[model samples]
Target: MSFPQLLTLLVIALHITGIVVATHAVMHTRTPQGAFAWALGLALLPYVTLLPYLYLGRSHFSGYITLHRSHRQRLSQASEGSELAGLPPSCTRYGALARMLQGTFHPGQQLRLLIDGEATFEAIFDAIAQAERCVLMQFFIFHDDELGRRMQKALLERAAAGVQVLVLFDGIGSHALPRHYVERLRQGGVAIHPFATQRHHNRFQLNFRNHRKIVVVDGWLGFLGGLNVGDEYLGLKPPLAPWRDTHLQMSGPAVMDLQRSFAVDWHWVTGELPPMLPPRPAQGDAYTLIAATGPADPQESCSLYFTVAINAACKRLWLTTPYFVPDQAVMSALRLAVMRGVDVRVLIPSRADHHAVFLASTLHAHDAIEAGIRIYRYQPGFVHQKVILVDDDTASVGSMNLDNRSFRLNFEIGALNVDRAFAADVERMLLDDFGKAVEITGDEYRRARYPRRLAMNVARLFDPIL
Candidate 1:
């Protein structure tokens, strides 16, 4: 065809594409409020409004992506597991998250808190050193610097000892990890899986990332928390300043649940499953359940879990997270709890990783503060850990943050601990953090800077999906 003829065909195809995209956008408006918000944003800024929608609008397709994804995963799961007696059946509690980890991930076990980062690191290294059967390590951000290099050496040492060592890192989160670093791991006979690569969109499963920072040693001892295996965690090299994070060094039967968590992700990344080392389930002090919420969840989201845990608080609630951009329901629960005279306290960072998210967090702080909710800003270092303590009777510690990103999109896991002593420790930790934190006053919230204020408001347009 001639140049002009080709141009005419291209324009026709472009118009058709635009029409299809517009149809999808309109169909995505579920609630009247959503429709109004979309209309308002599109009317105010026609072309630019699509920018935010592009990255966050994948869930609004024609099909029930949730069910379709479930069927696919079921097909994959069926081929792998046949033993019904040994597995917990991954049962669910009534009116809650699907029992994805019931019998298979037994949890009538002991729970131990790995308080200090250095101590946690020591526990992890020691676990690796002792792993006779298998070692599975997965982290969100694994730097190529000293800490990463040291881990490589240790994993190499383990692999050389005829132990099965498998390592997985997020392709995007650990993008800075050197190619040679991975090569060295392979050279030592360790299996390495990049959670997903960047080349293919299938590889770019960014939202459903394995955010649960887990390291299962011999399947009996598990380490999990906000601490990534890096210098900032070690206080060796600081990113956004010296980072302080929380972690769990758990033993007993609960370790199997964590092992199951890693196993699922491991199978997804690599067809072959990693062997988990754990003792057979016996009676123990801690009766626990590890909840994992992800993009495919249709019955419950992590937001639902947070809301339930927060609403369950009778006398006290203590929360700490780097970011605190809660969905309206969460903020309402906090306000209502405060209104009911519960001591609702939240600890957030003064200077977190994302300034815009921080601004967004303050937007909803007013009512809580006014209703007697106490807010604290950790002053010593960046507060990257996400934790919750309720009534000094129960607590949750894990990778989920107090933000919309964690609530809806990202894959996150956290342990729901109902033990009184564990709650006491969590409470004391919150109190200590409060002592170290500065307060965010009402005046500061009212008078946030222009760009931050603008960004928060702009981000609000997609809060339901964020």
Candidate 2:
């Protein structure tokens, strides 16, 4: 065939391939809405959807079009291994979620909530500086400011001293970082990789940004919480009012799970795979379960986790998120939990990063109040933390907001502690924040300004895409 005929044939083949792949993905996904969305995109933007799948789809048999297959394999391996290996002795009789997580990382896990941003930073930075072997980090925004530079300097020193170091930063999130930031680390022998580069504008790639903020060193120490690698996360300087956040510094067998996550993301950024976290004896008095959910599997795992946990709640459920635009499942579950007398309470930012989310959260919350679920809006500083305290024995903390973006698009890692003491501590911290918040009632809900109601409804319509 001539050039024109050849090109036409290629286009036809690619379009057919796109439909098959989209159909296969939707079938594997199982969610009707997700299937419709994927199929719709494939039908409308055939090339855009097809090209991304060839590279980023979950199929291993996709051949040259198989994108991130190695990374996906590493994720599956790490998730499965850590989930089964980390169960603490005290957690021998725990639930399925705990079991699955325990089968992955350390079972005996105790986590302390560091609420103050500065205090959280001190805990994390000290741990980073003390890392004896490799420091694995993946952050959404590694700003180019004072805190970012300070971290870069320390990471460089450690890497130069032959400490194994790998860092992953999101391309879009960390776009403002100095152009030479990665180069600076490269020159110091520290490897750095940007997740989802500009050349790959894969729709899901853009949607599934790594919102996880993780720090793991020597496979013995790991930090997960709200604070990103920035001055603002530390609350030293706030872009909008004073910043408030939380973090957890964990050492014990559970650290291995966090370490595993770091290693996988590190490998994705750099071509070289990092060492697996060797199993260790359980530490601490509490049973801890480490769980991660993301696009790597084409499953919205965090949202599913939330549903599972919420459904399992029989007594009480309390959630705090800076962003509160929850997915349909989450909303229904919370409402149902309340209807079942679970005493559901959701704490959201009285003032947050986006008016749309904040307002939509209020609307959902209005219904929650009517259903006997208490809702509070924190009016002090911005609550940049995300945490869920369920009943008397479990608490989950991580980078996930309750918003749709976190549940449907971005990657999130949450730590579930089965220790009563730790869970109580988290509950108390949440209660403390709740005390500083203003509770909303039906009367208050009815009194919302017309403009505000309009804005919130508009926001609700966009929640699916948030």
- TM-score for candidate 2: 0.81
Which consecutive 10 residues in model 1 have the weakest lDDT in total? Answer: 89-98
Candidate 2: misplaced stretches above 4 Å?
Answer: 1-105, 197-205, 237-239, 277-280
Candidate 1 lDDT over 165-258, as tens digits, reads 8888877678788889899889889999787422244432344455768887777777778888787787665555657678876777767667
| Deviation in Å, model 1, residue 114 alpha carbon | 2.2
If scored against the real structure, what TM-score would every candidate get?
0.82, 0.81
Which number leads on lDDT? Answer: 2
Model 2 Cα shift for residue 2 (angstroms)? 36
Query: Per-residue lDDT of 384-427 in model 2, one digit per residue for the tens?
Result: 88888778887778888887667766767878777788888888
